[model samples]
Target chain A: MAARILIAEDEPYIVESLRFLLGREGHSVESVNDGAAVQARLETYKPDLLILDIMLPEMTGFEVLRRVRESEITKALPVLVLSAKGQESDQQRMADLAANDFVMKPFSNRDLINRVTALLPAKTLAGSGQAPAAVEAPMSSDRE
Target chain B: MAEISTGQRIRELRQHRGIAQSLLAEQVDISPSYLNLIEKDKRKIGGALLHRLAQRLEVSPAQLSGVEDASLVRDLVDIARVLSFDGLDEAIAGRLVAQAPDWGQAMVTLFQRYKDASETATALSDRLSQDPQLRELSHAVLTQISSIRSFAEILKDVPDLPQDERAHFSGIIASQADRLGLSAREMIALLEGNPGDEIERSQAASAVHEVEDLVNAQRNHLPHFETAADDLRRRILAAHGEGSITAAMLAHLETKHDVEVRQVEGDAFEGLVEEGVHLVDLAAPRTATRFDIARRLMAMELREEIEELARNDRLSGEDARQVARRAFANYAAGALLFPYVPFLEAAEHYRYDMDRLAQRFDGSFEQIAHRLTTLRRPGAEGIPFAYLRSDPAGNISKPYSLPGLRMPRLGGACPLWAVYAAFAEPHKTVAQFAAMPTGERFLFVARRVAKGAQAAGAAPAAYSIMLACEASYANRLVYGDPFTGGREATVTPVGFTCRTCSRQNCGQRAQAGILQRA
Candidate 1:
């Protein structure tokens, strides 16, 4: 469906695999490692889905999620958090923080693709906020 | 060289087999007396007998000849130095080897667990302290993660993302995974036991200690300085020493010594000498203020002698200058309060109780401890004492140890010391019979001082001051009451530093040092 996905992660290999799988599934991918940069990228890239890693420079994923949920522009942004810590308290905190989906790292490509597709389908990429109305309809039908 | 001896190993295995020594000697084709002699280390057995004995004992000759569990005993000694007063001596070792050998092994195993735990604790205490390897790995992980994500995004978002570009992205992920793995391994290995190169030296402390040594080298006594200090003491007492040595004493200083004393505003120093007028911090404690004036008066009276004594000191030019400036001044300040003879008599009377002595002299615990270390009067010497100061984060600021037991110049000290535990209970004096790795026991005492808040919103300054004297003199100290029973008395074992410690299984050990395997 050619969905635009923004991945916020620090580990490059996980991001690479996720990007490849998402690209194959017909989604456009943009990634920023700095958690603080997520908001700016959200307004500019306007990705349909945000894949966030828990540990990041300057700001952490949990901090980014709190801000995203509060801000008007990124309030409805579906965020899939990635973490290597995998502590129960961390998971519970993410859940309490209202992350849409959380995947523990070393995540498989299949797991990432599935969560990503559920958050932003190929067709919804246009409506996910940047593409024009004229292009949205054709991209939706082009998926079949 | 071997941690365990072949004879000890044979004794252990034979004891485990539960066979009579006579029967075992018959099987090994050696006389019972000869076997007994070999077991007791009175006879040397060559490789031929070593193999035959190994065969009879159903154990490998390597297990017998190699530095086996004897290394375990060395570690046990190291660990015991932290936990108790005694160790597995020759008699006990012989019994443990011949009767219940597992006891020794069990102790060794227990020590290893302790070593591991101590390491974990000290590492956590030093969390904010930087580890270069950790920082590097963290950076690498962040970079690799970013690269992997970026390359994958390129392959995903860009349509007809060239097949070559796709291949490149795949290769990066593969390469980065290896990089990440390497980074992870290094960080993990560091955590497992490596004490990396982050231990820093405090130049300020060494400079101060250099001055301390200059004073100490003279047996911490200055007869000429003492004579001059005595005269000043008599004069001050005759004039104003009947009352507390207060800031008001400046009137006498200006008239008698022709020195002007003035109060100032600043945190740069407790007091400073400016153009012969003594500018002291008005906000400082009254006791400290009095000490400063004493120093200034002493300096003015004994300038030539102080310079000559400092010049005679065996220190570098800069260090000698520092000593010349501080040693006499600090000595006068302290001597004015404690006054050697009375301080020593009071210390003996009070059993070196810093609190009681401090109250008697109207001084701080630190002031008392500092004075306690300097009681080396020729014929009537007090217990030879050493002092150590550290914070909860494992930073040792100032340390003094008796000759032959130089505490590690860097790091907080053995985590197992009661001084560390004293931090958990501030303002309380905690005592322990602590042994060095050499098994030389000492009566150790530590008290945590909460220096009160700097500002209303800020937390108070915290520190642990530990003092100790050789256990041989333990009877003279009331702190040694617990170990009065005999040589069988137990004591807490500790190391100079983790890196220098041979105790292998100390749970509190933060790093695996050269003595790691032992």
Candidate 2:
């Protein structure tokens, strides 16, 4: 039930960190570096939730959101906007576009996990529950 | 709710102290009519009057104003109720009372009312009376209402005319009132007159229309450049995320571009150039002055703070000022490096190719991008542009624009802008069609770039920068071609007027301005 999540981010460090954390949470993750590939990848992979960075190459997150909202096929898909642009107007704009949620970059790992976890379907949660349990058990064992 | 007004309190206090009205007026140094109005709640007591009243009344100003007393109103209410039962009202009719408590007859009526209401009523009354927080809240609410009423009264002085004309006048007043959160009825009440004749109505309508039109024009006159500048900014920021603008980067940009940048010092003013100056030339004089003032001010403000730090033996005053001067010099250097005129012409000539422009100016991609916005010289102007530079983490380092543009006061730039996208692609130019909250569209170019750190050995910081122009000028840029996809590229809507941006659909907007609303 773990849903596939796509992360469109330009920063390598951020992408790597997000991949590591989301991977630990047990969702199938596909990461891309720029906005150029977003539409094509969405058509093929059809990610259940798109984690999009506001600043992207070739296209901006806004343009991507606009296109996503415009397209009949993926118009209903939930998108969680991730951005380094931490402005009230920016957040307000994202909210107006019907984005499921937004998280600023340089974000807390826990916050990211909470947001990603909240967006996944119940089935996906159920599927990923076992993986996180396994992962937590190892860390707890190490403490012991 | 019917507690004594500040003026009444002053009067009451004066009488209690056995002071004459004229003497109190003298002490307060205000006209008797003004004092009378204050007591009747027709006017508010100014701070100066309050201070003098306190001095004359032998009480703290806060106590006289009832700002410090919670039970003063309840005490008056109780006194009034007791005095009512004792026929104290008749006593007042019979003799002019000249002191507090000497009017014990009035207190009798107040006390009787309190007794008749019973203990439960008394407890409720006590709760309302003794609660300092509630007293403060009530006072604040009353003060705010009084101010609103004052505004209404001021509006009343507007000349009266025909019925239709009055309505037209009312409409304009209503719009202004609406901005101030006042209702149409309230505004009409404030004006206190009706429009009468048809001609007057037409005039009023025209006046309102003119005002609205002026506001609209100002809102719409935001200057914007082509998408190439945005693309250039993105490339620079992507390369140097969240770092200081450095000399090395400036050098690198200069070496790459053929553009000449010369640094000049001093406060001397020279006569204007006889020949018509280019947009860049117009900007140069002011830019120097602005840079000098900013530098001087920053140094003055930081000198003491830096000196204090140095006292802890951390750094010397000289060291601190040196750093400040360096930072200032760097900023000034950036301004000079991107001299507005030549860059604007170059941008126009090259159709805003960032790489080509960079090469032409011998500037780093980011430096050129940042400079694109300073083209706002009034008569001989370049595209009035707003520029923002942010680090990789999205902390805005610099944001500036021409007069009409409204950049966000805090937080970050609009996420809808293409500048953020450029951070992902370091060298490549990114184009975006962005709309402001007001639904105005513009083509933007953004890119990522790097700048060297302070010391020679330190690693350079990577940041993202964005140069944006209005969509009206997009036809002059080559960057729009990609978005066109063989067809003419649809002009992307954007705006610099934060208050009126109508792009309600934007997720990056923190607050939709007045015009952005449906």
Residue B309 displacement (Å), model 2? 25
Q: Provide the DockQ value for model 2.
A: 0.01
Please give, for residues B237-310, the per-residue lDDT of candidate 2 as tens digits: 45666343233233324444422333332222243222321112222333333343333322333445434323
lDDT of 2: 0.50
- Candidate 1 per-residue lDDT, tens place, B264-303, comes to 7545444464675777666666556667777777777677
lDDT by residue for model 1 (A1-144), tens: 467778887665656666667767777888997888998888888777788877778897779988987887777667777754223345566777777776754344456677776676445754454441111211111121
Chain B alone, TM-score, model 1:
0.56
Off by over 4 Å in 2: A1-144, B1-341, B402-405, B453-459, B483-518
Restricted to chain B, the TM-score per model reads: 0.56, 0.35
| TM-scores for the candidates | 0.46, 0.29
Candidate 1 stretches with Cα past 4 Å from truth are: A1-144, B1-206, B239-243, B247-249, B258-279, B312-314, B317-320, B450-460, B486-490
